[model samples]
Target: MTGNQASAGHLLRLIRTGEATTRGELQEATGLSRSTVGHRLDQLFRAEWLRDRAGISTGGRPSTRLEFDAAHAVVLAAALETRHARLAVFDLAGTVLAERTEPLLLEDGPDKVLVRLAEWFGPLLAEAGTAPGKVCGIGLSVPGPVDWEAGQVVQPPIMPGWDRYPVRRRMREAYAEHVGPVSSDPLPVLLDNDANLMAYAEQRAGFRDCGAFLLVKVSTGIGAGVVVGGEIYRGIDGGAGDIGHIRLPDRTDALCKCGSFGCLAAVASGRALAGQLSALGIPAASGSGVREHLAAGRPEAVRLAREAGRRVGEVLATVVTLLNPGVLMIAGDLAGAPFLTGVRELLYQRAMPRTTANLQVVTSSLGERAGLTGAAAMVVEHLYAPDRADARLAALESVSREPHLSPGPR
Candidate 1:
């Protein structure tokens, strides 16, 4: 793309984020030439990507206020997991316009899951009246160790069928086949750990003021995502915050899916809760059942969950001592339970006094929507990254001029 298109894409990003103003403001935000800025703005305005309004006079020439066209751009977020899948469409402002959820077991088989996902997303987009060009890209959350650089899901222990799936490539192929030609404006797909996405949502929408934090998602299984200094701390092999497999000091018999023993998930996750509840004759097999039992004030259910909480807290206390994050966000169904309160109490007791004193543990604000919202936020963040518009505009310009710079055969 030309320098003019690059500048316009940047301006469009700013306006979409609700930060647009006069040409002076754009010039200040991005060090571009007055003529170049005007050229870009005109290009964007002509493309219907930006709408201008006359600002109130300030004892001088009235400045034209620019705003992004809300209907001009869209985002598709796909959250794929073991038990279910969720697809959502989000506008520029992070508002979810349309979403659909279905019980498509993701772990049954990778190829089957991929085909079904394509089918699901295609219909949902049609129903929402969303077109291919309007879509910025797709952000996906997967329940596995993701090799972000390779665009593949590394071996996930819990997923019996998905050893290694080229998730990014498959999704992009499906989108391109159904949508439009994969050109400079080709649809991009991003894959990240589901819990990491939850952490992103918590960072952006939840405890925004916290300097450092950890989000623990206690659902069918337990996992954590750490954000230190406003960055997701994905470790070597993208497994830095996989705390669920952390060994509980006192237990060695409980085994993890990763072929280990004494892990937090083995002893204190939703599966553990269900197991404990079942032993107590509570029949609490699912997270929803655990919630129902807690709501019903079932003593056996509460007792076992409280014990599970203490164990989870003990594991987290070690993390607290090591990382010392300012906040600990408990998410998923177990987050709202009194059992988690027990976990919090144990966390404070087991953690160092200074760490406990400074730390604040609480339930997630976004609740069930945290994962989905995080998926949407990932798209927004990717598209709005400082250099994203530059790259996108360059690619679009190449394609617009040549119209043949499509992805080469794999």
Candidate 2:
């Protein structure tokens, strides 16, 4: 490989991913000379991004195994729902240092919610004993489709004022306002759909070997996330898995938030069931409220949720036929046994036998924290990948060369 291509960051990525743990293995994998490999390893070691551990003896001398030091950096993550938000400070390895969930209505608009998130970050960082400079990047999970390239939400149904919002810039400004100016640079902010992040996290943690993974989130709105070959399949312009807007033939009168009639979400979403319950003298309003009712074993809520699940399952029948996912996961507030059973009743019955032969229908194992976990993982992976990692390393090295300035705060 060329010198510009085989950088210290590239070598570190190899070690971080377990692709090559020893110098000899790195040399073999990269086709670099031993001296070139040694130079790269030294740079990584000096940056504290890599450490060495004793390795098993093979022949002449035992090789030292290189390992990624996850504690070298931290990530800030937030998952914003329609009615509430969850925020956390995580290490590079996706371990939560400090986290909290609080009520913050999305309809309040981007400025207010983002400022609140910034306010929360201060205490969270202090509580975790993480300094501002230690934060490598930030990740935000929202309940809408994201223009990943633009770092903005695009035409969200529930989030009225957030269409094409400058989420990343506002978040960076709020963060600076709350935490004071960062030394090295403003932290990179990344955004994605909540269901997409949840599905990505679940598949990586449990079903990494599965070539195709699908997850349906049955919350205030219904959305699906699909992962194929370990990568999220965001269709052209990030609108691939918007199964909630799929129209149902029989529910012609149901009106969705997106101004469409007969949309699946209008009939089968948590919001729909809550409205049905409210009409029947119940006080349900949000998806969380529906979850509470379900937990209490309310007969009407249970029945309605199951019916919703069946509707979702009917739609998923086509998805299964098209994607042929090996693992179909049910997540969000309505991911309980009754709902899953109803889904199975429709999905297995309607889908082709060949599709269902090896499909495994399951519930979310990460529960409510899946989005947060996935957000952190996304940030870590993005910031530390080979190409990006080299730039970051160069920035760090340049800062180090200036003897007057130490490596930013943490």
Candidate 3:
């Protein structure tokens, strides 16, 4: 292999993914001599990024197995809902060390939400018994469309006054203040749409081999997340899955948060169902209120949830035909049996037979943890990518406290 191809970062990736375990496997895979492989591996060991353990004997001699050291760093993840937030500290191996949920309304605006999230992160790390300096990066799941490269929220209907908000900058500064930053490297903050992260997490956890997977979130609002070939299909501007805004012919009189009428979310979201319930003297102000009523087996909420599901399913039929996804997962507050039943009714009735044949309609298995897990996983991927991993390893040797702006995940 050439000098660039035979870089230590490349070799670490192979070992980390288990493509090359033994020294012989590394030599065979990279076409480098045993001495050359050893030289590159030495750098990883000094950085405490790689470790070894005994391997099973294939024939006569047992081999040493190389592994990525998960304990070398930690990740901070926050899943921001329309009216709440869930945060956690996770190891690189995706294990949750500490977690908590709090009330954080989008109406409070971005500054308060981002700063409070950062401040709360300090205590969570303390509870996890992890040092502040161990944090490598943070991942945020916001309930809106996000420009990944720009690190800002796009024009979001529900999230008022948050258009093009500098979330990344604010979060980083808040971290330095609240978390007592001391690392030579600047901690990175990655942001993405909430539904997108949930889908990414679910696809990787349960349907990894599925070629195409789609998740539709039916909470306060409706949104869809698409995963193709194990990656989030976040179109050109991160506006790919805005199915909630698809205009419905009969809903022309319904006002939507996007300052438009006839949008699907105006008719079929949990908020919409809650509004219907409230009109009949049933108290339901938010998706959570609707969820509580549904959990209590309230007949009124169930009936409305089913109808909402039918309307959402109407839109999903067209989506299924276009994407031909292998698995369709319905998630969020309104993904109950009544809702799912209604969705299946319309989806199967309207969609082509071929689209439904291989499709497995299901609900969220990870439940509320999906977004938090996805956020942590996103951070891990960004930090350990070949090029970033090389820069990190180099930073470990040299004491430079310069902030780094990483390119968004593709």
Candidate 4:
């Protein structure tokens, strides 16, 4: 119906977002002719990226409603906590198909942990029944500040020997080695801070309407993730939410992992609580251990966790006044009822009335899976968005064009 061609990615995006679900609607949205829409739709159909079903009629025959085929590609997601890691294989729509929990320590450094992740990919892919070539991308969540563009961590206090490491490149190579060679070429990898990813997933899943959101993770270390206007607010160099290192007036002698004294994390983080608990004859060694102690209703652990929450809440009081986030989420190992109660006590008491008026202090709904889900969603959005989707489509088409070449699982 028109001389110029419409982009397949544009048409696919329209359908994927439910903006234009029918051929007529797509033609109208893009100002393309029906035939142009048909041609573009054909590309997506051939790639198994979209499917169509009958839609309700307005006045005439029912139109076909196009929908994104989530099964078209899969994403591998990993969340590297301080003491353990969680890995999952997810479809394009963020549905986890396969998952595993492993006690991989981040203190082992990036090389060993990332290599272990590579080793796990083969079995994970097999379990998910996803071919190596079908993997669109991989997403990793690490407990550190990430230079997102460089795909590397920067001066992470807890992640030893990982500063400025080439995580994406090394992880890609490891994947290729473990899963096969094909995974090396087209499979993109992305990395971000764990709290950032967790906040991203939680906000998208539960508070999509909230323009400003905040998530504080109180595990072995402490960190905050901020989302403003539906996007992560990574500062100029990804150091925006390092609230854990905020110097506290009362804790001037407390030593922090960043070799700083008086940081809030040094006084009130889960690691701090664990140390205090151990001194009290409890066996708490890490954040997870503190969680276990709290689960068993250990009085010392609960008391320390509540105190930690109060300290974090004091900082959040200032944060609430400044950012006025609609949702202030408390997450990580120390996000239980006692901690939440303590946070509420200080936050509500210290923050201005106007700030607390609209604020909703909530706990994590996604639990340990938040980071993985966020990682998956991050990969899906990055790879399938309008600006990037066309190039990906072109690459896919090029591979398809080469009939003799077999795609390997890199």
Question: Which lDDT tens digits does candidate 3 get at residues 1-410?
Answer: 45458677888889877898888888988989888899989978877788999999979778998998898778999999889999999988899999999999988999999889988999999999988877888999987898988888999988988999888888889888888763434568899988999999999999999989999998988898899988889999999899999999987999999999999999999889889999999999988899999999999999999988899899999999999999999999998999999999999999999889999999999999999999999888887788887887776645323447422111
Between candidates 1 and 4, which one is better according to lDDT?
Answer: 4
- Across 1-410, the per-residue lDDT of candidate 2 in tens digits comes to 55557788788878987999998888888889999999888888777888789998978778888898889888899999998999999988889999999899999999999999999998999999988767778899999999998999999999989999899889889998898666347679999999999999999999999999999999999998999998888898899899999999998999999999999999989999899999999999988899999999999999998898899999999999999999999999999987898899999999999999999999999999999999999888888788887787788888889999887732
Best by lDDT: 2
- Candidate 1: where are CA atoms >4 Å away? 1-20, 29-31, 40-49, 56-62, 176-186, 402-410
Sliding window of 10 residues with minimal summed lDDT for model 4: 1-10
Please give each candidate's TM-score: 0.87, 0.96, 0.95, 0.95
Worst 10 residues of 2 by lDDT: 179-188
Predicted structure 3, TM vs. truth: 0.95
lDDT of 1 at 329: 85
Tens digits of per-residue lDDT for model 1 on 1-410? 33443456667766665675778878767777788889888766654556778888989988888876656677788787567888888876678878888887765887777767777766777778866556777788876777766767777867767666777777777776665544223467777888888888888886767778898887777888888776678887787777888887788988877788998888877777877788877687666677777778888777777887888888888888988888888887677667677787789888879887888888888766777888777776776564775565555545557766542211
Q: How many backbone clashes does candidate 1 have?
A: 0
Which lDDT value does model 2 have at 200? 97
The C-alpha lDDT values of all candidates are: 0.75, 0.90, 0.89, 0.87
Q: Give the best candidate by TM-score.
A: 2
RMSD of each: 3.9, 1.7, 3.6, 2.4
Residue 148 in candidate 3 has what lDDT?
83
How big is the positional error of residue 279 in model 3, measured in Å on the Cα after superposition?
0.7
RMSD of 1: 3.9
